[model samples]
Target: MAKTIFNTSEKSNFILNMTEEQYSKLASRGLIASMLLVPLFTIIPEVTDKASYAFSAGGLAVGGVICMILALIGMMKKYIGKGAVIPVIAMGALVLWGVISLINGYDLNISMYGYHNRGEGLLAILFYFGFFTTAAAVKRETAVKTLINGIVAVGILNSAVSLIQIFITNKHYQFVSVDDEAMAASGLSMSPIFLAMVLTLALAAALIGFVTSESKKRRILFICSAALFSFVIMFTYTIVGICGLVFSAAAAIAAVFALKAPKSRLVSVLAAAVPAALAVVLVYAGAIGNITSYRTYDGRIAWWADAYMRASASGNFNSDIINIDDPVDVYTYMNEKTVDIIQKNPLTGTGPEQLAFPQVRKVNDLTEIEDIMTANDGIFDKDYNEYLYTAATRGIPSLIALVLALVPALLIGYKSMRKRKSAEAFTAFVLTLSGVLMFFISCSSIAYAPIFWAAAGTACAAIEKPKKKEATEKSANKSVKAEKEAAEKPAKKNTKAEKKA
Candidate 1:
């Protein structure tokens, strides 16, 4: 042995020591880092004077590229499960159709860069890739725990910032605004609605953590975080935010009970509804601000009417029915114009470029309405509803593709929640549910979309069971522990014998 140290044998042993399991874990950690970084990127503001809408788009693009590379590596190492393929394929189809539409319409600048104030054209496709990649890449329990911890940490930070902005600061920041009477604690997001959406998800995550955590300290911390997030949501004064919070809470309650007691699901659902009902009562009773004020209700009603009018060929079309200066009339007119464009190219859509620079009626429109239409520098059409926006801009096929992608994930999350007996599973389920709710309520903001996709991916990734190799490692660890104990026992006996001698 002293004479011979075989280099070939040493090299062979080193190569054999590197197992596939180790490679999988390395890839999983990389994906976890990317996922955690996305929320942080949402807070970065666009400081440049350029017409770019999202300052965070560059960060998102980089994160997306990194996630894709990590996902490919996971796949190569066979870390990703079979279930991850569905979301990947569905998202891929959506991006593929969007690109095809862009090519057919052939407006390179607008298609590639998107319109000012809305940087979600080509860049948004990258987000979906990031989402699918995360879903596919994460396969370990440590990875799941790390992702949940990251979400909770960010949520707590967001809540703290919003609270500080509302209470201490009268000045405005990138996303925070405080005035004499009205206060919008946008935190890291420019839009109050977007901030609300993020807070809603955070609240859900906090709640899940509270319900699932067994440790006393962790439970208390999660409860405090949940309360802070809830306070932030109310202060934000966004109707959509309130609605989403109520919906997610109710869903989470029902999900928890369904898993714990399937037979009591209905009772649990009703119990969950109590908090929302109480809030509404408080609003109507003037104990709190009226969430359903005439102004808010009327505006939503007007938009719905506008969507209906545009989607149909009814003879009841009356543009002058409402005052042109009114937001309803302006939104209706814009939506009607969008509908006309969608009808022409329902399959591939009018392309991202045409949708960005829509041709609206120049004459016989109020200056105020015209101003609203041209608010985005006459370069993009704005739709509050995500589903309608997708259909209008990317075509029905693209919308359908998105639906297909979401539905499976939603179903998977729902099923997982019903069977969840552990904290990790519950966190994934609640986050997924919160993301789905946000998609329905909030407009597709670049700041918020990445968080949503990351949540969805983590949820999908949580479904993977532990591998055999991990169990083998655990057994090997136990065997080593036993051998060490045996060696210690003999040493102790020898020490005693020496003492007696």
Candidate 2:
């Protein structure tokens, strides 16, 4: 059976060098990547990026996170005894919000099942709860490398698909998720924003790998992977995504310098950071391509301002809509319209996923405002600002609650990085930070949000592994051995003395 499984065609070198235990350990380590691969490669061919592909992929990834967290908990039951309480309380906020939405909420149907083409509702929040649970429950430090490997593989596959789409098909393909920004980048679930988030995390992991790895071949592999992820992020062209790579690279290199490792490893981190930095400067300066939009800063500010206005004041926007060419004009009007909504519904504002929908919009309960919204048809589905959007839809406390939930994991990863020299801890810290930052630019999608959530959990899990403990044990063993040797020397000396007498 072993011969059949291993392919007997290589008869000349049929003997295996690895013991069964070694092989088993190798296969076990691959489990995290194996489960993640199901979602990484899954794409519903018929729908493309419209709906089910993203939803299904997200569901699968969430399931995988849950399964791994449970398995890790079982393996480390004693480790979680005292640690599990805080995580449960932190994550239980999701259940609280979900129950409120179900029991006494506006439009229970929409709350339970989010609006069309968007699945970020009660269900999505619960899945996130699962992600935080992983962070709270997991104790395994060995799985960090495997998780990073899975992320790198997904990012590489994304870049490959995008390259093929850009060159061969002329920016038209359905193999991976495609969007209007399909020409910008492809593969995985989103266009520029979410795809950028995934690639950003991937680049961070690769740089971390470069910092941690000692072997020449493994170091080269990590640098190459970092380069590949950077190239894809360049095509993304979004400000946050591009800047994320540059800043995260700088941070990683700086972290390596701070680590006890030889200053020589900083070269690999620099190798990853320089090309990405150069690209950002050249492209913005019009050396690579005429992407004037990035240079003219007014456009993005106006875009975000418009989203804020839409989310904050659903009523006033339809009838008294002012021309938004001037950023100052839009900002002034947005502040005017949104204030009343906050004053009225401070505790639980409107409902879940109800932003920019006329039928369910509760920005103002005035009859005239309702008529205008119904007639005009609210077009903006998302506020593009998650902080304000969350406060507006879920209320101010909900947003605060969400932040509080993540605080523990962030703190855990941060403490680990500061107290000890662990590349895994720093990588998780940076990834979670990036995820939190991405919210300012875009909303969470099922496709890429898991990466952030998983990172948070992995951050909590970056404790000292058993090997470090064993090394300390070896030190203790050395003293005992020395004492035994010392006693034996006296016995041998006395025997010699007796023989001489």
Candidate 3:
């Protein structure tokens, strides 16, 4: 009668009744699956023509949704830590701002779907959500290790493919063109620059894995992967790709010192530099000079100069001094136009779609800033710089939200590095630093943005240590130990007394 009243058999049927360890194990599987799928979906298309890049986006979305659901379930079960609250709120605010900006701005269809061939609108929001969910839910140390291994595996695979494309296929390292002859390893991405960004992050992950791993075999595997990634970066020959490597290396070195990790880890990380420097030397020494041209460097310098001169001239530079028809002229023009738009609409300047599309405006009797916007219509998809683009389109609120979303992750890493001497803390520091570097240098495309956001989330989740919980646990442990010691001392006294009696 008492057992029937309790209904013990039905208790197992309750979803929330699951233990924390059980929930964590379930969430870990989902996190690993998502991490694996993100790279597999991205890299498979480069090897096979049957699959499109959209499949990659689809895979990322599916993985993200799965992780998000699992994360919500973990939240219900109280498996996720309270330390994750700030990051969750920040990411949520970012998504909310994006939606609000889309609603207030121009074309609904474009804002929702993004531009042709580039689905960065609503899908990007989902990607960020997935990132946040994965970070919040995947709290177990085993899950974090699985994620790192997945990253290293992807990096090694991509590196092999790129090596083949460069050596066997004899393809050029092109950034804009899809022609097989131009880009050696496009890796299902639209450009080599994008692929390079992914590879750089993977390389960093591999280095972390190598340093933290105690197993000899695992360390060797990670070292091989790191070497391959370095080769691929050198072969890609994209300026941004090279810049990303520099940023990644800088981040790695900074993280090593900041986390107080072993100095040997720094040496291992910098080992990639030998190959990178050799590749650069080869390029300059005329071994690969024909394939790698310095024209792009010159063009970028000219572009920066023109932007500066135009801004200095208050967007009224004489056409005689600077050719209005030149492509470099657009950077200055767009910069000025973006400033004007932000000044007019500080809250919500325009929609996401408007930012991607051409915005024409007559500046004065002598100049008009329509050429660059029109030129960017189909040629160059984004604003090249993500921060400027976000500020111009979604206003200051969205930009602030986007920035805020990253801050908690960085703080988590910093705090972990300061407090913990474990490998997890070091890994979190490097991952966060890599994401921040990529955001500053690369365009925030769906392909790259998801990875960056996921890294941020994973870093946060890896180091979720609430002070109150820790204190309570320490106090409880101390009390139990004291009780045992006191009980033991009385028992020993009684045994001696009995022997004497």
Best by lDDT: 3
The lDDT ranking, best first, is 3, 1, 2
Off-target runs (Cα >4 Å) in candidate 3 are 1-15, 42-52, 170-184, 250-266, 281-345, 360-379, 462-501
Q: Backbone clash tally for model 3?
A: 1
Better of 1 and 2 by lDDT: 1
Q: Native-vs-model 2 lDDT?
A: 0.56
Q: Compared with the true structure, what per-residue lDDT tens digits does model 1 show for residues 1-501? A: 212246556455432343444544654455445544544554543223342234455555666677776666656555555665687678888888888777766355656655434456765676566656655556655666666666667667666767665556522321221111333455655445666777777666666666555577976776667666666666555566677568656655754664453342233233334544554454455443223321222222223221122111012223355442254454555566667768877887766634533444342444443243433322234455566667777788888988887777777666655564556666676667666666654466655666667667666664556568689999999999999999999999999999999
Query: Listing every candidate in turn, what is its Cα RMSD in Å to the true structure after a full C-alpha superposition?
Result: 8.1, 9.6, 8.0
**Cα TM-score per model:** 0.71, 0.70, 0.73
Give Cα-based local distance difference scores for all models.
0.57, 0.56, 0.60
Q: Where does model 1 exceed 4 Å of error?
A: 1-53, 168-181, 255-338, 353-356, 359-380, 418-420, 462-501
For candidate 1, what is the TM-score?
0.71
Q: What would the per-residue lDDT of candidate 2 be over residues 1-501, giving only the tens digit for each residue?
A: 333334545444332333222322342343344335434544443225444433554554456555444434433343332433454455567557655644444667656655433456676666666555544444555556666676777677776765654444422221111112223453554344556777888888887788777778877888888887786676565565666677668766766776666777777656666666665575566543334223212212223222222112232333246543343454444444334444556567656776554334343544643343343433343554566666666777777776775677677668767876677667777887777777765567555755677677666653545676788899889999999999999999999999999
By TM-score: ranked, best first: 3, 1, 2
